[model samples]
Target chain A: MDKPLNCTIKNPVNLTLGDIKVDMLCGCKVVDITFPNIMSPEVGEIRFKNFYVATLTVKAKYRTENTPRHTGDQPKWKTCLKRVKLMPDPHSEAGSHDYISLTSRQFRCELSNITGLRLILHQPSPVWREFKLEELRLFRSAGGPKTSPLPTWLLEEPKAKVQKKTVQRVASSTPKGGEGGVPDLDGLSANLQQLWALAEEVSTSQTSQSLGRFEVDGCYDINLLAYT
Target chain B: MAAERRKAIPSTSDDNKPLDSDKQFLERTNVNAVVRDVLGKIIANRPEDPVTFLADYFEALVEEQSSLVQRALRVITMTHHSRPVFEVNVRDSYNLLSKHKVNKKLKGVNGSVYTELLQALCRNLPSSVTIKLVQKLECFEHEAVPYDVFRSSIFACCVLREYAFIAEQLFASLDIQKIGKADKALCDAVMDQLKTALGSSRNDVRRIIESSYNLAPEGLHQALERALSREQTQGVCTSEHFITEACDSFLAKVKKLK
Candidate 1:
């Protein structure tokens, strides 16, 4: 991987934007957004994941005086706002938004790796006007259904001899999901059970690999050899 | 014992021959593995014609092994090792993928292959090659170059120090409001470098100051004012006199333009 894959949640998540404050000025402006932490009951801690979609239900109206002049040609006035953009970073490309009229217009956006959402309002007319945001919501889809749990190989004893046995157990097991389930001590000989217990103990005790020997002189020799 | 030994010797010999041939065939045909190995070699040797050899070898698999293009690109970038050869490989693979419509499979920000390609170029290739790559990227109508990649190129210019003018040009081209928090930090870092360059060397301070002004005009003015005030407090006539003079002239010009 070029960089570490972002930590993600396996379940769908949502955030309500009722209390967040938005600051705006006359002419073209932007709305400020605040994102809340998504807590998982299963993980028993706060889980942070990028949102997949943002839905904004807003009520806004353009001042009639700010409307564009109607020339003999087509009326240049925009009944709806133009260039409505939603983005996480101030610099990134604005996510998708649909242009609609003044009463309860819903704007949906698909964005990834965003901490907060910012709204950019582009109005052609140079008139000062106020825009109201009635509601906003953020949603994230589950990372697909949880697959079968991680293989037992990762939890196996790390000793070379026991590792070989663990691989054999994993490979010989059928896809039926019960072959590696419970070790039947009732069927196994006492000696085999003792051996298995010993292997597990050895594997768990060593948690990591031993640091290998190092020789500064050997490294110096190799460096010198490269020049030669 | 003698019969067993006789059987083992022939069996071992037969196994070794087939294994070697099978390994050779796989190495020659497996497009992903071959591309990865070639990328590694390019980093080490920087061959002249990186794309041609791979292109010819995978002429048949070009259509079949289309999925491997992302992997190949990932290998090039993830290794954090780059060369002219790797740059060509990345461009050629990107083209091939686009031709086959394999890029449709990519998702989200990761799908910005143009940005990834440019990032690799900025990190690995020479300044001239990176400049050319950026030019090529700008010409594409469908692909909008990511600001992170642009920021990285600017950072690369600062590190190279020879291409300060390119950094200036980049700062001027970008929209100030579109600069992200990370991008803002990079802008500040580059400006700091420019300030150091101005104070120490007899280089053209006008261009550097102009670029900084273009990047953040108000910020630059505030910084200059702060620096001038700080200098006054110190009560020392240092070499910073010329920088202050240059800033004054640039600020005056900006006022005239307004």
Candidate 2:
């Protein structure tokens, strides 16, 4: 759709520790990119320029009360993607410069309350002189329509439903037609009413069958497994 | 002999010290040896019900000199002395893979079955092993994979993990006749990749390989040399094929030690 890139990146938070813009990351096995005190509830997509790495593993850390803790800090680091091959052939220079986008669906855990991301870059061959990803960015939306349109039935008023019921009652009171080719609408409405009554009776019987008690009418000697 | 053994029972009035007659009875019946043998079987098998196990044990003892107990005892002793080495039972792996219902006309296993087979086989092994194996197979895009591909992919993973002993056993169990050939250049290339992947843990992997297969330092070197130099074929060697040959050579070295 040729949507604009980085349009939803509001207030890109810097590193929690340092202020350096460009760092020499040669010979480094692991690098971390983090955003401190992010206000977004969820991240829609993440994109980064690839470097000379055979395999790039993406791990995410988030703060969650649902996860139990024994002796650690409030939010702990957890693994998301154990291994992701960014550059298929590390020895070759084909896909080394391409930008890779990881959507929220790709992440193993929920992308909310995300504190940091760890990028583990590995080059299985020693031929690469330098390796590091660049231009890392996270967006709140993927530049597509957020939700589908509501169905037409959901937008109708309550008066329409009352009109439908009144039409069915009128059809049921009408007499049969003389022409044999025409279908009987009166008989059809009567059968539909009978079916609806049967369904309601079954549902009420199910609800009344259970009393949530072990004894029947205060008699503890009753056999629970008895059929009748 | 039974009469003589029974006569040695001591009186209840005596304390912990066994009388001479009681000692003689125990010695004649070999009570210690019999008890040790039975207990060893019970511990090794670990049945759900101990009382039922004991009843069956006594029943077996009555029917021909307790040969079953002696066999079970042998298994226990052998396992105790050796490291619990992994064996690739292809029949068992195939049985597990085939248990999931799939279309016979498809001529391959379902993708979920393939993943489950890898997980089941790689249990107790490193998680990286399964991850690497899945990536190496490159069959995630396919709806189904042939049986041969699955077998070879598993072997490739073991080789990558430096599990030469396991890889070698899997080769034999899968009845793989020829993994083609690799020249010295191919071996050197594959080894370089492995060295880079392992990084500082290369020595640690070597130590593990040595301990698991009981290989000496010089013996491992000799095996690698033989595997690289002995091949004369000019066939194109993939990384997996080269590693398999190296593991086979390691197995050959182990067999020589025995």
Candidate 3:
């Protein structure tokens, strides 16, 4: 979502990967998820601001972060990483391709209508790493494009600094667990470090309850692999 | 009439001597009547430690006078008035209560504890019971339930959030066919809550909406979809708006996910 997508995501799409165990949310506290989508159906109709959009196939992989311990007695957890992909339903949008290569490679949907688009955008797609503009190319769609050293989106990179934590627990209380203390960076992930900056902003918002936490352990792993 | 002691206790007067409202207790033949008596007492007594009194009240029941034990509980739980208070005071009593099954056979007799507990369960009421009421007010559909059961169902839904199996059991008890179609109130609640909490930024709105959309219906779901669409224009939701954004983002992600 930070960069321009090549295609339009006009409609809602349902694409799935593995072990997700999705269910149609049922009853009282169960939130409503569109039945078709919940059942892993192929069609989607997304609307924003009361405007109905097109339907497509949207595949997502659920991701999280927590460097799972490689061995036991260490008590580890898997930080699921997810990447989302958007494509025109091949059944609906494409035919047997004369160009084998285009057909073989998966499609990326670039939404032409950006009026009211919402992608959680926190995580990246499996195809995302491939989409990074590494060399910073400035070419137009048909190759008759203007050249520039920096792409249009570049403003200024912020100054980078290493921050330190003076985690002073209450003097009276002992650490909660057996491994009384954690290595400072053991649970920290790149995304969490970023959220830490957001946490600073939350403290200034004048709210009674602290909605955001300084806990970087879970978020880091999810964001690291997904948001990168 | 009877001051017969079941077990030895210090406050013999409160236990043995009939309360000023003894006439009402004598008239109580079923659980609802007992519930009315206990609720009236709690509302009137308004004791800081009603739970303790309730426990003492239940423990004081004798074999012949055992009706008092279940009767007092019936009064505490029915009408949804003092159940929480009762639960808090006799915190362990909830476990005991959930385990007890009310027998339906005893109705007109003096010791109709069975009929009493059943009536006190707040079931078969004509109006929509709260527990079932909320369940029936669906983004989808739910019904076939009662108030106390509905209240517990909501909590049950929340508690089983991490487990799929538990979620299934929670759904099974719902008044599914009775629940209506999508609701606009959900949309209003979500949008209003988000706007109040996170401001009008599109990204912030989306985060806010997503935060509550899993619990919304109809137009609010529409609003959330709108918020998600606005992300590109406003930029991804910033951390300052994380509260609204994180949840909206998660909900949108889960829905669009394959």
Candidate 4:
């Protein structure tokens, strides 16, 4: 028996409301999970060589407040997959564990084709309101006589794509007066100078309070935002 | 000099009156402060039975200050422990208020304090209590009560398996047209509950469905008929059962009325 291929989501994978960017009250959606060894051998084929079953064991700890105030100490877990088909494992009859086996071709195809896994937090018990992803392990086993260690090739972690920023350099030279360049003021006419002088005189006179002054009253003025 | 001296002397008239006495004057003068003070004390002390204490305090306030009472009630009911007491207090207050038409007096308060009380009471109250509240609520016209409040009360009754109460009190008495206009979700919820009740083999389902036929709006009757027919066609319903007979009789009655 080959030791199961295990993948761990980096700890504290906080589920968030995508638009508001706030922590989810009850559920999480894990997307783009790629298991290295389980890739289709052929480009479009849905079959995987020696694929049997994947056991996902999640050890989750919920937020303290998630437990109902009435129920003391005993925190009930009501977390479940929203879309994934999970069945009770017949092999492990002793312990209570959720299992999903790719025993059939359709199930294997579904598993291979899914883009993401969504987990929903159900009701009755409020204990599943918020939970921390403590440990997540996926164990893959092929039907065999002897157990072997999970292949190192399948354990290679996916690399995160880093964004590269490109810097733009400004042009080296400044243009002299020409098309799309600064206008030259040296060629001003006498009539234009007279008009400019008059405009400057009016601006100066306006700043000196040549306009009539109106009496300002403080009473009955309302600040709309003030409650009083 | 005399005017200045008179201004210098602080008015002791406000001090002479009992705190709750001259409620109208006090409310006009410092209603917010009084409300805050009362709320502060209630929150700080965390009484053994806050709902009753708050209700008593609210009653002391003049009717003009009913909003403050509503606020206090909202606060008390929001907590987990005070729910049972809140239900009892609400029932008493609703009865008293209904006798005097308090919801009408506080019409400016938006659906009145009765609506708020109903909404709060419906949140996880026992079906028995919910039925009583719904009956009391029926005193007001369908337009006066908020659709959500009415829906929640109905939903509570349904959840408690009091389908008969829903059929007789709500479905029969409510303005089906207004409910349809105001909140289609509520109408759908009612229909769903009715269907669920009708599908069951419980001894009461027959009685409940028959009563529903008597009180159900035309649209609801039609919906029920369609649902029953669908179930019948699928061979899921046996003719010997009460549901089939009830459906046939209801459809016949509806056709006769038309």
The candidate scoring highest on lDDT is: 2
Q: Write the per-residue lDDT of candidate 3 for residues B1-258, one digit (tens) a residue.
A: 433332233344656774433344455545556567667757754666789756654555433455443644543442232234543433323333433433464222121332233333423321222233222222211112222332332222221121222222222222123232212332233334333433323355344433332222322233433443344433222221332232232122121100
lDDT of 3 by residue, A131-186 (tens): 11011111112212213435422322111110111122222124223321111221
Better of 1 and 3 by DockQ: 3
> Residue A138 in model 3: shift from native, Å?
47
Per-residue lDDT tens digits for candidate 1, residues B95-191, read 4434333256743222344445444545543444454434433323234323333333322322222232233333432223323211333333334
Score residue B165 of candidate 3 by CA lDDT: 24
Interface RMSD (C-alpha) of each candidate? 34.6, 37.8, 21.0, 41.5
Weakest 10 consecutive residues, lDDT, candidate 4 chain B? B249-258
What is the alpha-carbon RMSD of candidate 2 to the true structure?
Answer: 34.1
Which candidate model has the greater TM-score, 2 or 3?
Answer: 2
- Report the Cα lDDT for residue B43, model 3: 77
Report the C-alpha lDDT of model 4 over B209-238, residue by residue, as the tens digit.
Answer: 343332223323334333433443222222
TM-score of 2: 0.24
Judging by lDDT, tell me the better candidate of 1 and 3: 1
Error of 1 at A71 (Å): 99
User: Backbone clashes per model, in order?
Assistant: 0, 0, 42, 4
List candidate 3 segments past 4 Å from native.
A1-228, B1-40, B44-84, B88-258
TM-score of 3: 0.17
Local distance difference test scores for all models = 0.34, 0.47, 0.29, 0.34
